[model samples]
Target: MAKRIVLFMFMTFTSLVLSGCLVAESKYLKKAEEADALGREAATLQEMHRELSAENGTLKAQLSRVKEEAAVLAKEKEKLSADNRELDQVLRSKTDSLSQTVADLRQKVSDLEDENARLKEEIAAAQKAREENVRQVSKTYEDLLDSMKGEIAQGQVTISELKGKLTVNMVDAILFDSGEAEVKQGGMDVLAKMVDILKGVQDKMIRIEGHTDNVRIIGNLARRFPTNWELSAARAINVARYLQSRGIDPAVLAAVANSEYRPVATNDTGEGRAKNRRIEIVLVPRDAP
Candidate 1:
């Protein structure tokens, strides 16, 4: 019985020791699992920290680019402002020069206007002097026409003095044919004598005045003459042309026509109608006061 108790006690002690070792192993396994979980958590934290650092670096790079862009924009703005100031200065200088030029031009225009008025006044004075000289010379011209009165009467040419002027009336029968502008052969001698008398007059203006009776012209000859007025005008022009061809100055000659307007006598009478168709050569001073 004692030997049995001894074996049993030994078995009981072995069981107790085995139970303590199991408890220690269980505690060690729990500590190992906690360590493994801590390691995983630390690895997760490290990954998160790396990602944050990379994002921070990217943000820093973006900020640096933004600062560089801002600096470039600022420099461009300054350059533009400087250019605008320079342009404004140039515009001001040009405006001042233009204003000065306009002022000078206005002064010049005023001076030119004054000079023009002075020149006009001087011209008027000179013209007045010339007219006075012509008036004095006109009396001598009239005296010469009076001296040829006897010769003019013999040639069937009548002379009359009116308003200090002489009028020579030559009939169409003595000067031209019917509806014709040609001067007759006998009229040539009379005109030559008159021209000779007028040659002595200084600054003489000669006018050849023509007149015609009222007659409607028709046919080829009438087409050339057109009307009595045209015929009279042509006759006067022809006489003036003849005088010019005979060495008379063109400046001294003037020709005109009057158709049945300046009749000294009545047109109802044939003799008065004949008298109405006439040519007159008038000698006058070029200018008169």
Candidate 2:
């Protein structure tokens, strides 16, 4: 009996020890399961952190690219502003030039208009003076024609008006003897009458033109008057001096000698020679120059 009881106690002790070991084993298994679950959760959190870090890097790169593009846009905007200012300045300069050109053109037009007005006034004044001169000359011619009617009818003098010139032609026989430069009594009377009529005309210039027939001077007359030219010149000068002595202004008198060159008719006949030997009084306008 004692041996059996010892064996039973030993068995009971072994069983109790075994039960404690089994319980400890079960707790260890539960702790290991919890640790495994924690490990899985940590791995999941690490994966999420890596994804977030990569997303942050992508966002940083996008921000860098955006900053670069913004810098380029700012530079372009500044350049465009500068170009606009330059263009505005150019436009203003051109506008100023155009305004000046227009002003100059206006001044030129004004000057031309003034010049045109002055020219028109000058033309009108000139025309008026010319008309007055024409009327005065015409009246003088008609008065001369009437005054010398008797001499004209006798063929001793001829009065003619042409192109504003008045000419009184007197035959040499009525004024002087043959081959003589001195005036006869009849010539003196004719010259005195002409002087009386001519004294009234202050505006016209009087010219005495002496003409000679184509006859050579001879004898004592040749000594007094060498050639026809000398005889004609002496005759014209004497006539002009007589006119001056008879109240005619010397300023209005001119003496000319035409020797045998100017002839009114053929000098081959005696009657034609008589016609060619004559004294001519010419009335010319004062403004003939």
lDDT of each: 0.78, 0.87
lDDT of 1 by residue, 1-289 (tens): 9999999999999999999999999999999999999999999999999999999999999999999999999999999999999999999999999899999999999999999999999989978856764564455446545665665666557776554455677777776767678877766765776665556556657788988776567888877877778888999998888777777888888998887678777778887788788888776656732
Model 1 residue runs over 4 Å out of place are 1-151
Q: How accurate is candidate 1 locally (lDDT)?
A: 0.78
TM-score of each model, in listed order: 0.48, 0.62
lDDT, residue 167, model 1: 66
Clashing pairs in 1: none
Model 2: per-residue Cα lDDT over 18-107, one tens digit each: 999999999999999999999999999999999999999999999999999999999999999999999999989999998999999999
Off-target runs (Cα >4 Å) in candidate 2 are: 1-112, 287-289
